[model samples]
Target chain A: MRNLIDVTDLSVAEIDELIATAEDMIAEPDKYAQVCRGKQLATLFFEPSTRTRLSFESAMLSLGGSVLGFSEANSSSTAKGETVGDTVHTVSCYVDIVAMRHPKEGAPYAAAQYSEVPIINAGDGGHNHPTQTLTDLLTIHREKGRLDNLTVGFCGDLKFGRTVHSLVNALSRQKGINFVFISPEELKMPAYIKENTLDKNGLSYEETASLEEAMPKLDILYMTRVQKERFFNEADYIRLKDTYVLDPEKLETAKKDLCILHPLPRVNEISIAVDSDPRACYWKQVKNGKFIRMALIMKLLELQL
Target chain B: MKIDSIQDGVVLDHIKAGKSMDIYKYLHLDKLDCSVAIIKNVRSGRLGKKDIIKIDSPMEVDLDVLGYIDPDITVNIIRNGVRVEKKHLALPEKLVNVIHCKNPRCITTAESQLPAIFLLSDAQKRSYRCAYCEAEKTRRV
Candidate 1:
């Protein structure tokens, strides 16, 4: 049961394979349209995430597969105290594959533990979101034409941002991948990610408070919203909230080939003025999410979705 | 209630004074055939509140369950009115194949056939983390 729980679960070879598969899907979308024609994807989104849910459903739909399951937990049997195991046990009988999202960190893993079908972790609280990592990988592969030997800067709430954490962990496995972690001192990348993923793996990464200084040298500038609630005090929020915003002026200092990425729902972190730049690949990142997920659904079920 | 301790039995001690029932429920000792004695709300010079549960027959209890319910439990095997093997309930090396992680988003939580896997990262803190999702939760042992 090769569940997509973490980025590490997919080895370098498997990741390359997934990237290749995604490339194939991109090349020949019509050929693989009806691959999972009779299959159904059960999207058990316990959390309220319209974007991820729509992405998964759209992927299934584009692949000629049917979709079932609830968008919110309140619409499901979970409101009656139905255990995750029981919910999965029942849902597995009805669907060919399952994509689950929940606020509890390990809930999807627990569901996969008892599910008959393969489980895809859509997102698990502040924990790992392997599919999003796959999306980021595909976007990086499509945009940069490679996933190695590049300097990637991760800006804003790196500490608790699951997307940043997952992508950094994924990129750490590749060779000559130097990372620039740009953030306020309070929301720096967590110690475990620094120690376990970077240092333990012998990856070189430098931490800096200045995004503009790190901009020119970066091949990829990944922006994330510095959440207001992460501030312990109001004064700290006012001080650091606008520090990492990537406006047009910042991109002028960056390389022409440098791609700016954001795992969207941006507040002020990414200026609206930067949208016209060909370098802003965040929208492309979202579309790649659908394509990569389309590839993943097909691969997991042995279908061509 | 006076109950005779068998030649071979297990005695649980140092239970928090009023928490004997929780331990009893967690251990499921009441369902067993063994003669069990539970002394509740007992006074101790060391502990402000304490209770005791003595089982008159040898039985194997789920150590993980003990850890989950009350982490401060001490188990002593009695042989011929003498303490033989003292088993201190410690968290398991790898908490796999038990206790379903409460997180619904976890891959382990969604798979029906896979064992509920957990790894006890902190022994002192009784913090068991999910093997797949890495969600930490404290269970008393």
Candidate 2:
């Protein structure tokens, strides 16, 4: 594919290939260090995102490639009201690839239409985040050595969590994957997603308000922050923010091999005390994010590792 | 009373009743400098009531959009006041720049230059989704 705009853009085989490539990068990092030598990656972030932007930059740098472009729209020609198409066209002339994060849902898609270079969607407005999905996939592959037959529990904000949606969509394609959605009533998984991704695929899934009850049966626990930004009302945000914090007490009943994952910049969803737990692989997930991005950049650039 | 047949033009027949105005606006029929007639709530054997638009000038119309709005629509071509050819419409596989995506965060909303495209994802449900954001197209704007 010319661009990685959504998780669905990658097929099951391609995801496996990426995971394998990521594993190779982890084992022998030096061999792939200079794969992207003399190349340039433009990071055009229209919104404020520290982790995703940095991870992309780090991925490129580790591959012996250079990084350019703006971290914010106001810092770039976008402040002058330059269109995404125009910006992409201009940036494509200078860079080999682009990793764009925008507040607009399909801004990267619009850019991809005009870009001569490969475009990677770092994040979009509550839309799909394919790279994070990749990161999660790699993490799961490393932790459990398989993507199938796992009872995965998604805790906290499943409604507005783009990561949850992307991961669910990706994982649903795997065989024997059952979803245990743990969230409050107000933050239940959207019907369209349930209908289109899960129900359409004939995937098994169940919903519950209690994370504790779901913990024992879960092979993987994917926790997401209840975003204050997604809430329109302060009262609702306050009420739901602390609904499902993954403390030591909550993790007590979880399986010893239950791999806990989270897309970082987490806002008090997982407690600090649980960080030392063997199952808490979120930190490793972050590192895996960089490795997978490196793999993806290499794949998009058609460089053999 | 019977509406006069156009000598050389197009006839949009079997439009769902009350939807002719939307089609007129969508096609910019008002902007056409030709004789145009809209017959609304006309009795028909196939359809209990329907709307028909007769344009007395030969011009290109977006059949795909017509299909999207109402797949049951029939487009009849008139030549020398004779019904030469008739065409039926079904939902197009993909529609480009036909309707704006309503999602506020959709790329088309931010970049006006980008054509708002929708793909017919669910044929049974007649559901279309924005090609860019994958947001379901609820209505035409």
Candidate 3:
């Protein structure tokens, strides 16, 4: 693929290739350290993102490549009414690749149309973050040694969670994957997603309000924070924010080998007391984000392992 | 009474009732120098009531846009007062810049110069989704 705009952009074989490349990077980090030497990566983040932006920069630095570009739109020519197409055209002339994060959905996609180099969407509003999907895939493959035949339960905020949607889109294509959506009625999975991604693919899934009821049967429990920013009213956010907290009491009913994951910068969705649990692989997910990004960068740049 | 047929022009038939005005405005037919007539609420055998637009000059009309607005529309090409060709339409596989994407966070909203593109996702529901952001196109016109 020329660009990483969405999780669906990568085929099943390509995803497996990326996972294999990431595993190779983990085993022999030094061997691939200088693969991107003398190259440049431009990180054009129009929105505020600490983890994604830093991980992209770290990934490039570890590959012996340099990183450049602004962290916010106000600091760049975008403040002067420069369009994303113009910025991408100009920046692609200077950099080998671009990792862009914007508050506008499909900003990187617009940029990709004009960019000569590959465009990696770090996070585009709530549309997609394919790199994070890659990170989750690698983490899952490492934890369970397979990506198929797993009963995965997505807990909390299925309605507005872009990561959940992207991961679900990717996982639905795999064989023997069943989804158990655990969320409040107000935050149920969108109808288009259920109809297009799941139903069209003939995937089996069930929806429920109680996470505890779906816990014992889950092989993987993906937890997401109910963001206050997504709600129009503060009272509604306050009322629904604490609906699905993954505490020790809740974990008691879960499977012994259940892998728990969260795309972090989390606002108390998963309790701090559960951090020491063997199944809590979110911290490892963060580290895997960097490694998988490294693998992706190398793949996009067409560098051999 | 019978409407005068054009010698060499285009005839849009089977338009849903009360929708010819939208098609006329959407196609910018008023800006054309040639004569254009809109026949609204006309009786039809296939439809209870339909609208027809007759243009007295040959010009390229966007069939995809017409399909998006009303897929049941049929376009008849007239030459020398004879019906030369008939064109039937289905929901287009893709549309370019025909409808504005209402999603606030869509890239086309941020980049004004970029054309709004949508792909037909569901034919049964006649649904189109933005090619960039995957937001469903809510506004039909």
The TM-score of candidate 2 is 0.96
- Who is ahead in TM-score, 1 or 2? 2
lDDT of 3 at B12: 97
Each model's lDDT? 0.82, 0.90, 0.91
lDDT of 2 by residue, A1-305 (tens): 47999998889999999999999999999998899999999999988888899999999999999999898999988899999889889999999999999888888888888999999999887888899999999999999999999999999889888899999999989999999999999999988899899998888899999887898999999999987777668999999898978889988898888899999888888889999998899999999999999999998999985
* DockQ, model 2, C-alpha based: 0.80
Ranked candidates, highest TM-score first = 2, 3, 1
Docking category of candidate 2: high
Clashing pairs in 3: none
List residue ranges in candidate 1 displaced over 4 A.
Answer: A227-241, B1-92, B96-117, B120-128, B132-141
Which CAPRI category fits model 3?
high
- Model 2, chain B only, scores a TM-score of 0.93
* Global local distance difference test of model 3: 0.91
| Candidate 2 residue lDDT tens string, B1-141 | 136767889999999888999999889999999888999999988989999999988888899889888889999999988999999988899999887788876878878778888988888788888988888974442
Q: What are the candidates' individual DockQ scores? A: 0.30, 0.80, 0.80
